[model samples]
Target: MSNKAAVLVAGSWGTALASVLADKDMEVALWTRNVVQQEEINTKHRNERFLPGVDLSPRLAATTDLEAAVRGAKAVVMVTPSSAAREVARALKPFWHEDMLVVHATKGFEIESMKRISTVIAEELGCDEGRIVVLSGPSHAEEVVNRCPTTVVVASQIAAQAELAQDLFMNPYFRVYTNRDMVGVELAGALKNIIALGAGMSDGLGYGDNAKAALLTRGLAEITRVGVEMGANPLTFAGLAGIGDLVVTATSRHSRNWRAGFMLGEGKPLETVLSQMGMVVEGIRTTKAAHAISEKYQVQMPIAAQLYHVLFEGLDPRTAVEALMGRDRKTEMEVMSLETWEQWHT
Candidate 1:
């Protein structure tokens, strides 16, 4: 009921969301550890390193003191990259309380532990995981900051928690939908980045739309397979967080995963590609986690497996593509039959 909210970190997406809240007339305090970045945001209303040429809302303020940012806020939005999520949540513990709404927009698995971002945050906060809401969909920071029409979905095991996120962030240009399948929503958002990287790789290798289309189609199947095995509803894969997110992430030039994949396809070494990115390309890390998850679940994830070899085992991208083309054939329904759906959901 307080119009005050806090956003953790000032990355591209984090800054964009802060702007959204500020535009809606909320007092938004964004926390960042970098003193220079904090001054730039507060003084110039510009975050050139992240959102170039975009004017941040004047109502949005940046702070170097984490407690000052979080102490009185009614809501806290966690937008740190997946790698830093646990550490950030740990730091917020002293200032965080159950009365504050916890929502996260981060989109990746914890590569080392294969844990979802919300899980990591909940563990650190010592609260029920259901109290955390996940915000996800086919959104890019560049588009959202420009006030482009965008729709996103929020999920929580608890309906009221999901509604809390929906009410806080929804606006005319930014539409929010609610769903109860938190597991499906979180997994879909994270896994789709891996396919986007492959899509970029296909384009970088001079492949046509036909190849990309097939890749996207099969990639969704792979994502749904793993997600269902991990307690996600199969039908959730047909919704926004699933197909909608997959289509946008794999096709958009704004996708960090796609850009990194293109570089890898252009024959740059993984180390060089990462150095050139300057920002975290989440798909690279998600690929590693997906590899481990697929093995742990005993699910076949051909696209993710080939990508892992290329990324970590020094396999040529072309050879990886060739191996995929030569894999044993099976009916498309082998993994997606109506029976499969019934079995997964039941």
Candidate 2:
């Protein structure tokens, strides 16, 4: 087994994780489709486009060739956007060895299939879904690259595999925890981006902290509701993958989803918002997938539904908030019945 690990993209987050491995004195290969980006990382040690002004580790390398990146690597981290995860995994299939640990940091679903990223990777790689680990939490790429104190969770159905990932990326500044709840972690990570968009929209609308707090609280409840319905542990929503991720993404200036929602809340069209942002706003696509998932699972996600309307159906942001406020009265625990509580406890 080699100490080499490959990150399957040179995006901000992927580059940051690659830096983490490099800081551990492990050989890290950052794979990118852009030849220019590859040259920039290899020569300048700076990815000016995605992560500017941070010096990457000297041990870090970049490549445009997928085979060179994956061959004989001990671990492969897939950090492609959720929409590209399937294509990237398919490209890795010929190079992927069974012994190599597979992990993904994507936090959105396939808009067309409503499939989680792990499902997409497993199907594409022809591997057991349990073998794939998910890395997620409150850490932002900008802060992470600067060696700021950050914590994240690596989850897999196979405990040993998750521990292997934990060992690979853990450092003094970057703490890694292991969990068995891959489904919960993945869902919480994906769903939180939706709430972040709402939070941004609230802020843009000039709504005070009270509204943002309400959105975070009610958002967690709805996310937990749908995740539990889909076989995730409800408690997982309270952990880093849940509230931790939600708070950071919703409030942080580094969040692309929040910025996109802010622009939309300022009355910019979706096309204009996307054009100005120049990044993949996962929440927009995830909102579409969540709308479909909510219908498929018969789960109620009022915030997501309203977000779907605002992002896709051209509903005004203020009108959407108004609609949320105007909804019929219900108890705070509307989604959790006594039977549900007993089932979770049992």
Candidate maximizing TM-score: 2
Q: What's the TM-score of each model vs. the native?
A: 0.98, 0.98
lDDT, candidates in the order shown: 0.93, 0.93
lDDT by residue for model 2 (155-233), tens:
9999999999999999999999998999999999999999999999998888989999999999999999999888888
Can you write out model 1's per-residue Cα lDDT over 176-256, one digit (the tens) per residue?
Answer: 999999999999999999999999999889898999999999999999989988889888889999999999999988998
Stretches of candidate 2 exceeding 4 Å from the true structure: 337-339
What is the Cα-based lDDT of residue 98 in candidate 2?
84
True-vs-predicted CA distance for residue 37, candidate 2, Å: 0.6
lDDT score for candidate 2 against the true structure: 0.93
